[model samples]
Target chain A: LAKTTQPISMDSYEGQEVNITCSHNNIATNDYITWYQQFPSQGPRFIIQGYKTKVTNEVASLFIPADRKSSTLSLPRVSLSDTAVYYCLVGAPHRYGGATNKLIFGTGTLLAVQP
Target chain B: DAGVTQSPTHLIKTRGQQVTLRCSPKSGHDTVSWYQQALGQGPQFIFQYYEEEERQRGNFPDRFSGHQFPNYSSELNVNALLLGDSALYLCASSASWSGPQHFGDGTRLSIL
Candidate 1:
């Protein structure tokens, strides 16, 4: 499993864009960078996932540089409801021949979206 | 469809007692995984079951064990529990081994 490092907390105002970066220096070639959003008392929701370059979804966007050692999760036009913890995970999508695809969440960055 | 569901939203147990928590996976999911979350910390993986067998596990002790039934529902059993075992036990269900997983509300276990 590739250990990830991210900010512990971040603060932003509503309607502003927020970007949280994660560092996974030991990322493997088969690993994918995934981000999840977790609200209080709720399970972590999948936000975006990408293997390389950029991938955009209805909720968020993931940008991975060519180096693959780090990635960033970008949330556009944030709202107070978007205030939650965001987790960054780096692992492969396969289950066999390596560690299980179990997600190991970090402390997460507590994003406080002010209104 | 109904998402993953766990039983006994909250529980209180004493040290040295055994406790069982139940989880019903999502409608189409066949794999179940358990995790333990302490306050202010991220969840730690306990184990995962696929095809009604224990597939993978974390560093947790043998006192923590799990079973997955044919229906894909699962049970997490803790024997001779200690006070430090108090935490939120989470159950997640996935369609395959590496796909996205849906989680239940989790059972908050408080050991006294």
Candidate 2:
């Protein structure tokens, strides 16, 4: 399992963009960087995932450099509802090609979106 | 389609007692994983079950054990629990060990 480091907390106002970076120096070649969001009393929700370069979804975008050692999650137009903890995980692929079931979560970046 | 569902949203237990938490995976999901989250901390993996067998485990002790049934529903059992065992237990299910795992709201266990 690859360990990830991210900011403990970030503050943003409504309509602003937020970018949280995660460092995973030991990320493996088969690993995929994934991000999740968690609101209080709820499970973490999948935001975006990418293997390299950039991937964008309806909610957020993931930017990974060629080094693969670090990645950033970019959220546009922050709102109070977006206030939650964001987790960055490096998915360790199983020898059989499927990703590992074990998801290691760190403290995560708690993004407080102010109105 | 329904996502992962866990039973007994809240539970109260005492030290040395045993507790059981249940989870039903999302439709078509064949693997279930358990995690424990302490207040102000990220969730820690407990173990995962596939094919009605314990496949992978984390750093959790033997006291924290789980069982997956043929239907893919699972049960987590903790024996001789301690005060430190008080936390939120979350269950996540994935499809064939691929893609993102859907999670339940988690069972809040308060050990007194």
| Number of the top-ranking candidate, with TM-score as the measure | 2
Task: Write candidate 1's Cα lDDT for A1-115 as tens digits.
Answer: 9999999999999999999999999999889888888887666777888999999989898999999999999999999999999999888766764224788989999999998
Instruction: Please provide, for model 2 over B11-89, each residue's C-alpha lDDT reduced to its tens digit, 9 standing for 90 to 100.
Output: 9999999999999999988888999999988999999888888888999899999899999999999999999999999
| Model 2, backbone clash pairs (residues 3+ apart or across chains), number | 0
Model 2 stretches astray by more than 4 angstroms: A93-99
Chain B of candidate 2 vs. true chain B, TM: 0.97
Residue A16, candidate 2: alpha-carbon lDDT: 100
Interface RMSD of each: 2.8, 2.1
Candidate 2 displacement at residue B8 in angstroms: 0.9
lDDT of 1 at B47: 97
Clash tally, candidates in order: 0, 0
Candidate 1 on B1-112: residue-level lDDT in tens? 8999999899999999999999999898888999998888888999999888898899899999999999999999999999999999999888774567778889999999
Could you give candidate 2's per-residue lDDT for residues A1-115 as a string of tens digits?
7999999999999999999999999998888998989988888888888999999999998999999999999999988999999999997534263324589999999999888
